[model samples]
Target: MPWGEIKDTAAERRMFQRRTLVMLGVAVLLLGVLIGRMYQLQVTEHDTYRTLSDKNRVQVQSVPPTRGLIYDRNGVLLAENRPVFSVTLVPERVAGMDATLEKLQQLLSISEEDLDRFRRRLREPRRPYQELPLRYDLTEGEIARLAVHRHELPGVEVAAELVRYYPHGELTAHALGYVGRINRQELQRIDPVNYAGSNYIGKTGIEAFYEEVLHGKVGYQHVETNARGRTLRVLERQNPVPGEDLQLHLDIRLQQLAHELLDGRRGAIVAIDPNTGGLLALASVPGFDANLFVTGIGVQAYRELRDSHDKPLFNRALGGQYPPASTVKPMMAIAALDSGVIGRHETIWDPGYFQLTKGGHRYRDWKRGGHGWVDLIKAVAESCDTYFYDVAVRMGVDVIHEYLDQFGFGRNDALDVRGARSGLLPSPDWKRGAHSQPWYPGDTVNMGIGQGFMLATPLQLATATAVIANDGVWRQPRLLKDVVGDTPLDEVLPKATRDNVILKNPDDWNFVTKSMIEVMHGRRGSARRASVGASYTMAGKSGTAQVFSLGQDEEYNAEEIEERLRDHALFVGFAPVVDPQIVVSVIIENGGGGSSAAAPVVRALFDAWLEGFADEETGAELAAAGSAGESSG
Candidate 1:
């Protein structure tokens, strides 16, 4: 056989050509697939991948607005903001949260409470990469320490924010209140959009009442960051709107005087402008420093305040429910006169006591020797319990209840005052509802003396006295005098409804005013000594509320009882009687006599306000009164 014929050269060439064609076709398919995938990645899904990459380099942040400033009527700063440095952590960026927190604790003096609060916030639902505050108000040393160790930390940051500060410290604590770190409850209620970066919220008093107006709109910023999430530069920013400034009706001078007068005593004083219903001063002695509560108060510090006998944290001016005592005599006198139970010239005889029936229980008078024969004016001037007791019996309980109600005895409709208590005014129905007891004639006698279940707050007393000073025009008491912002005060706050307390005879107001005047200026007046050096004409009533009842034959000797068990001295007054300006109510807890303790305090306030802080025209009148010494005469 020939080798060329056996090899089949022609068929071998055809097989090689077929193999080459198949390999070239497979190569072409793979090239085409690679081109398609490259096109898809670079063109079709470009926006999606670019966005994902940019997220690692750029970040959007919420910019918190600055909180509002609080000022007194004279523009003295009450509450302001100060820059504070805080340590924060982003949980998602943190490599080992437990280890990081442990390191932070060692580096800075992180309290267990701080760590606990931090852990709570860390567990809460929040936006990814949001910084959570761990320790606030960092000292310079702590901040430097954190900076030194920044390279080793991944998510830890030293951030700066504005924190609330009270310049006056304990002086304006009760009135202005304080702002604190936002808590779980507040977070649930606050606007997430507006408060996105806000960490603090108002907790009480005016701060709490005007929270919305003080917390302005939030803003935003875009920043570029590196691999470690450190902000390199701001890409974009929207300036935040600062909160509105507040101007309170509080007179710092008068407020300071009230505190000085009440120093070393457990007491409260409230003063109001009769014409405007603006709060002039609200003072509760033994006040605690409000700044402590702003940045999270210590357990030990808070415990001391909570347990202290002085009750420094307690707001006594609007919350203290005390017996008004003879301070309400003028109001009761109005009731008596309006009911026709007594006339201006009505006289009552006292043998040191009065009985509802012959041989019944004798309601003893404050003066053991009795006031002798007393007319309506004399009774009011001397605070004769016997005269009130007789009129109370004759007018009955229902009439007394109706008349006193018109004077705001049992209610507080003051719009700006957030937590004023509605004092208890007892009636036949109230007695039955509260104690399941029937009304008795003796109860009316006790009510006439502002005793036995009649409770009133210092604010209520001031407001009622203001009504008298305004000549029966009932203006609800208020703390807010004006708003210094875009928002109208009425639109921002609830409207305070006004009404007139019209007496059957308008002369009744004049009659009561004159009687009150005599109480301060009359020779035999109970508060005559207190009025001796006053410049302007002041009308007032002094009272001693018994802390405990005396036996039928027992006499009250203040020296015999414990100081806390002694009577509470009280006084309510309005100055420049004809055209009254300020009305004041004061209570000295456990003080022996209203005339000696409370009246002196009132007189001092009246002098400070009328002589020291009054307008130019009013000051002239006060100067004339001081020179003439008509009050002394």
Candidate 2:
């Protein structure tokens, strides 16, 4: 090797060594960058990636709380929770919803309606993995079939849920109401935070009125889940508070008794504890089964209920508005005495018809043959339309309207129950305001006998009867006694006015009560047939409100008219007149002659109540006069 060759070789070797060192450095730098990036992803965002992975494996779901129970005053269950197995679906978990549903239908009989509802629920904006109810109250056979094919279905699930049950069925349906599955309408209205895990909501009646107390507060669980959204473990849980129980004022025994008395009739019966204003029995005949509404009533069942001629869904006790008929006579008599329009003993001659001097309209009495000369007491006892016509002419509509309004007649009772209709109390002003019509003299005469534009609900009539029983003390009628596990009801119902009746003479109350007594015990009492063999004295007035007007020459022969076209029978009374404890109001639709139909029903109710009282009192006489005066004539 020459010296130049040695120098060039040395330079080449140095350059090769430098290039090797530079390559080694570049490789080390690339390796360090790769290691740093891997560590950053694995350690810094571990939780975010882990959650995503766990979601694909585990499924977590919300468990709705059980609804509260409802009981009658006697501890009989009205509304309760029953365990129900239901098929549910999670649309997000389903690969092909239509195909899955088709398979589901093949496994279990699924109607078009069920499929339609399921599809609708799927379309609604909801959180992923949230179960949508597909079918409720699945039979054991259906459950078994679904379980056998459980592996074929991924998104479908069967779960036990607490569904509302009404054991009494139709008997207590209107009062207890029912609960139904939560819907979009309810979702928007409900507090999402509170109802985060809730399934059902109160639809109507007492259930709806006290929903807050009945629906328990929602709870939360912090759960660990897998990539499939399956739950790994519950890290923390806050136990849910169960709903408080409800004890209503309704008496099941009396309620059943009243229901029996109505017996296939379309009407209403309301019985109240005169002393406490607690509703004993508020029964509307032709009631529906509340249980049908719980899990979701079928379209056919719902349509039948809605379209039925009997109107089984109608709540007549609280909602039916009808002319009070001659049941208003006792109140009118009291009003007349209080207004100083007629003396208690003042006699009004009845020629079977009343004619206003100015108005040529002849207001005919119920009796074609004259009731003849009758006083206020006799008029009320015999329910003489002519006599009341005379008193009404003297008292005028203003005086009657003012006095009746005070007694809750033609007024809303503002009952705790939802959908209570305030019946029309048509005065000259009310008529003018509502119908844009002037008051007529004939209207006053019609009102005198509980006819014309005068209307009242069974509840209002019962409440008014209670006030009359208490000597004008108008206690506010109440349905709910108290809510369990809560502060006592804060509302102090208004006291019955001590001086409700403006009658200066205290004897006036005595006189009217005496007249009512005669109506039951008197021989000529219109309700005489119903009051046969009465052990206790009852004060009542029978009323017959014409469904359609008959011409002056036309006689009201009930048999001649169609059954639906007949008059409405009304009866209002309080038992054991001396120390009245129960007040009853009954109305029978197109039942003809309050004395014949309505009064007999009331008499039966009184008999049942008085019989119970007699048993408790060891055969003590509830009323001093077993038989007072019988004067229907």
Best by TM-score: 1
RMSD of each candidate? Answer: 4.1, 4.4
Per-residue lDDT tens digits for candidate 1, residues 1-633, read 888877988898999999999999999999889989888888999898888887888877889999989888899888999998999998888999999999998899988988887887787776567789888889999999999999889999999888899988888999888899788778788888898888889999899999988989899998999998889999999988988988988998888778877766898999999998889999988798899998788788999999999899988898889888899999999999888998899789977789999999999988878889998888888888999999988888899889888888888777778778988899999899988999988888999989989999999999998988988997787777777888887788677676778888989988999998988899878878778767789999888888899999997876789889998888899999978989999998897678777887888788888777544333233322322111110
Per model, how many backbone clashes are there? 0, 26
* Best-matching candidate per lDDT: 1
All candidates: TM-score: 0.93, 0.90
Which parts of model 1 have CA positions greater than 4 angstroms off?
1-42, 123-130, 613-633
lDDT of 1: 0.85
lDDT of each: 0.85, 0.79
Q: Which residues of candidate 2, in runs, are more than 4 Å off?
A: 1-20, 34-62, 124-128, 224-227, 231-233, 491-503, 613-633
Q: What lDDT does candidate 2 reach at residue 366?
A: 72
Query: Model 2 lDDT vs. the true structure?
Result: 0.79
Clashes of 1: 0
Query: What digit string (tens of lDDT, one per residue) describes model 2 on residues 236-346?
Result: 677777787888888877787777777788999999988878888889999998888876788899999999998999999999999998888888888898888888788
